[model samples]
Target: MLFNSSGFLFLYLPFVLAGYALLARVRPRWATGWLALVSLFFYGYWNVRYLPLLMASILFNYWVAGRMLAAVAARRRRWLVFALAANLALLGYYKYANFFIGSVNALTGAHLQAWEVLLPIGISFFTFTQIAFLVDCYRGLAGEYRLVHYTLFVSYFPHLIAGPVLHHKEMMPQFERPPGLNAADMAVGLSIFVVGLAKKVLLADPLSTLAGPVFAVDAHPQLVEAWIGALAYAFQLYFDFSGYSDMAIGLSRLFGVKLPLNFNSPYQAANIAEFWRRWHMTLSRFLRDYLYVPLGGNRHGRYRNLMLTMLLGGLWHGAGWSFVVWGGLHGVYLVMHHGWGALAGQGPPRCWGRMLTFFAVLAAWVVFRAPDLSTAGDILHAMVGGNGVALPHGLEAYASYFPVGCSFEGIRWIDFSGVAMPALLLAMVLAFAAPNTQQIFRHYAPCIEQLLGTPSCLLWSWCPHSYWGLAFSMLFLACVFSMNRVSEFLYFQF
Candidate 1:
């Protein structure tokens, strides 16, 4: 069930929260068990067929981790390798088998029929979380394991769908703590969730109206249209993914658990490295710890390891060459940033760096968002004015604003509705100027990073006051009103 759906918002969450609250007072273990069952039900609500697959995965990993913890040093290393390989093998078969088959078929002229495999929801996330646990067990970093706690760690609904991927050391202890409802946490979480709901319903969904048609065009879009579409998508994806992350964190907070921050105003990042540091941060951490460090990281050399890490990281997003190219572009951007820093002894000026980084990220997003390589190339070509530029029909009165001798003929603006352009601009302004959800809720320590820093005066802040409560209530009601056409979160596909 989608987090945005009424069934989830009204029925599922309320029932689970009520039950857990009641159980927490009498039996905390039963409360934890109740949460685990509820989480499993949540996952199964997406597809009953995959429920067994998820259960098997959890059981397998738990057993493997137990073995890894008890083994001798050399045996532990072997067990860790075995467990990692088993997880990767499952992920690979479900996520990559068809892509690999298609590639081989194209190259070798073999008619290898790809198997019809259904990827279980959140396979990548749960698999990686388990892998991290096994590695930690091998290294003696993880504490004692309990089947119930481990299951809860893997199946917790908030981070289960799309994650700020949990680490065992960070999450398991929370499951062991006494569970109870906190009015303060509930208020703050609801406020943060309302903010996220507004982002998705009011901002991200509307922006898709501007982006969808442009990207869907069979022919190349006009220069202005291409840019509008590209920028619209850039903002659409930003708010969509960031909005989901906010909701996830907020939901976890309602359970009195703190999830790591996944997004941090990445559009404002001054460099590609900084962008990576902010965007999908847990994924970056996973790549750095599990993949890059194991592959020798920067210790051996910066360039090769960085490129390989990003290349695999890109493929991890989806089974598409476009994603590979997107990852490669970011990899190139990072390498160039490193080279420039080495020669100049410092990075570019903040303003210049921010602009450059945003543009580079925007360009890579074209590939990421496109259906295929050809469409990406066409959009990129149009973005460079390969197709002529023109103002829309209503803007003809501004012809005098153009350079002398310049003709407006043949250049055409996209025939957007009255609200599209304004909405797009508004979304952009908010993206660049507004404080993120974490920033607004900084006082509550809604995310891990907030634990160390003082709250800043910015666009807005959540406070335990009547005005803030009324504002959030209005936002939540607005989101509820817009829920007629329920849409899945964009990250759900990944």
Candidate 2:
């Protein structure tokens, strides 16, 4: 169920929260069990058929971790390897089986019909979360194991659908604490949720309107149309993903649990490396800790490790060649950034660095957002003025702005239909000028503050005051009104 949907926002959340609160007071163990049951219900709301698969995964992983913990040093490695392979095998079959078959068919000209394997939602996230837990078991990082706490950790609804990718150490301990409702946490959490709701409903959804037509056009887009589409998508993805992250953190906060921060104004980063450090940070951490470190990381030299890690990271997003190219583009950018640093013995100026990084990211997103490589190439070609510029018929009066006598064969200057210039402008201002949800809520300690560090005292601080409460109420109402055209969160497809 979408967090923004009426059933989830009004019905499911209210019922679960009230039940948990009442149960925790009298029977704490029952409350924990209640949470696990409700979380499973939440998952099953998407597909009843997959509910058993999810439960089986949790049970299997819990048993594997227990065995790994009990085994001696000599046998533990074998157990860990086996557990990792099992997790990967499950993920591969569900997520990539058809992708692999299609690729093989194309290469060998075989008539191998692909199987209709349904990928369980969040399979990538849960599998990786379990794999990390198994590794921690081998490394002696994880402590005592309990079935109830382990079940809650893996199945918690907020981060389960899409995640900041929880670690066993970060979450299992929280399940042991007595659950209760905190007024302060509720206020802050609700405000953050409203902000995220505004972003998704108010910003991201509208931006999709502008982006959709451009990407879907059968004919080549004009130069202006191509840019509008690209920029619209860039902002669309930023707000969509960031909004989901905020809502996840806020929902966890409602349960008195703090999820790790996932986004940190990545668009403002001055370099590709810095951008990765800020964007989907938990995934970056996962890759670094589990994948990169085991592959020798920078110990084998910087360039080779960086490229390999990014290539694998890209493939992790989806089973598409476009995603691989998208990842490879970032890898190449990082390599150049490092090489330039080595040659110049200094960093690029801040303003210039940020501009370059933003544009590079913007360009790379074309590949990420495209359905296929051909579509990606068409958009890129138009972006470079291959289709020439032409104003829409009604706005042909402005043709004087272009170079003298530079008329195209058929097209006008640029077609601006379906483009919401005002909304696009507003999105840009918010992205570049405004503080993100994290920065706004930095002082709340709503989640785990230590990992995010202390907020800068100099920036504006917004505590949970009456005025802020009123402001958030209005925002919440606005979001409610927009719910008539409710849409699914973009990350759900992945």
Candidate 3:
């Protein structure tokens, strides 16, 4: 279920939270079972029939890995490989089969028709998590497995949908015990969730409104329009994906589990390497440890390893050539950044490097966002100085980016005279410059404590501002919750 949806906010989350907290006090083990069952219901909320498939996957891997860990025979290692391959085989059949079949059909001019296949929800996430579990089992690192803990690890609803990709080691301990809810953690979690909700509902959705029309139009416009469209999309995508990550982190915290932070203001990076370090950090780390290292990483000649790692990393996103191109572009950026740094014996000027890298990354995002390679090429062709059409008449015709009839101003009678331009300008500035709500509030704690003249002992020992912040945070969250049609988290597809 979508975190932004009213059904999820009003119905599912409330019901689950109430049940969980109630059960936690009386029966902790039962609480975990309730969670696992509820999590299944949550996944089935999208498609009830798929619940069996997901459950079977969890059961299969759980049994196989348990056996692998318990077995001592030499052939047990080979059986573990078979089990891992079978799990991957299921994933490939569902996710990549059509992508491969279509490519093959086009290449050979054969009469092959693509099969209709529905990708299971959370398959990409759960599959990877289990694969890690299996590998840990093979290495004899996985401990005694409990069915409840395994189920919770695989199906915890917070990161289940789109993940920070939790490792088996990271989540098992939390499942093994329940901690009393800390008021301070709840306050911080609620605050983060509300801020993320605002980012998705208010900022990302409105930016998408600005982006959609320009991107949808087939014929190119002036260079100015092209740049505007691409820039709007870049901003929309970042806020949307990162906004979801924030909500996920917050929700995980509600259960007394700390999820790894996924983003760190990636736009502030001075180079492509720095950008990767900040953006989608968990995924980047996964690629570095699992795929890159397996392919020799930097231990082999630098350029070759970089290219191979990136190409595989690109393919890991999806079974598409465009994804490959996107990864390859970043690989090229990394290689260039490293070589330049080595030759100069120092990093480039921070500001200039950041600007250049930001634009280059932005340009690559066009390829990543496009529906297909041809569409990507069309957008890029327009972007790099394609002056395709002349405006119809006077400057008034194309004065606004929106079409004549469906413009936001045309549809709504909201006063444009007072706060519209100022709000837009403020939002744009805040998007680029202002510290995130998390950072700002962290700094505000000290000032708030001092302003209240609270005892130094009490103030330092506990979060003095939590109660006040919690109330305001809940109100803001309610506001976001009320806006039900906000778009799904952007990373859900990946």
- Candidate with maximal lDDT: 1
For model 1, residues 370-432, the per-residue Cα lDDT tens digits are 888998899999888776665555556788887454335543435465556776788888777
Worst 10 residues of 3 by lDDT: 406-415
Candidate 2 lDDT over 1-494, as tens digits, reads 89989999999999999998999888877888888889999999999999999999999988988888898989989999898889999989998898899899989999898998988988888888989999999998987667888888988898888887999888877888888866556756777778888888888888887777777746467777788889999999889889999998888887788889999989889888899999999999999899878888877767877788888888889888888898889889988988898899877898898899999998899888888888888889888888677544444566677666434443432334533566678889988888988887775543323213334311112342325545766788888988888787777767
* Whole-model Cα lDDT of every candidate shown, in order: 0.83, 0.82, 0.73
Q: Which stretches of candidate 1 lie over 4 Å from their true place?
A: 396-415, 443-464
- For 1-494, candidate 3 gives per-residue lDDT tens digits of 78888778789888987888888888776888888888888899888988999899999998888778778868568867898788889989988899899889879987688889987778888888888788778777788778988998899888888887878788888877774455455555665776677777766766665456555646443444556567777877777877888888887777778787787878778888999998878778777766677677878877777888788777767778888999899899989989988899877799988888889988888777776777677777867655443332335555677344322223121223543334344555765677865565556433334424544322222244545544654557566654756577767777
At residue 242, candidate 2 shows an lDDT of 91
In angstroms, how far off is 90's CA in candidate 1? Answer: 0.8
Between 1 and 3, whose lDDT is larger? Answer: 1
Q: Which stretches of candidate 3 lie over 4 Å from their true place?
A: 73-76, 388-428, 437-478, 481-484
- Judge candidate 3 at residue 439 and give its lDDT: 69
Candidate 1 lDDT at 64 equals 85
- Could you tell me which residue pairs clash in candidate 2? 389-413, 390-412, 390-413, 390-414, 391-413, 391-414
User: What is the lDDT ranking, best to worst?
Assistant: 1, 2, 3
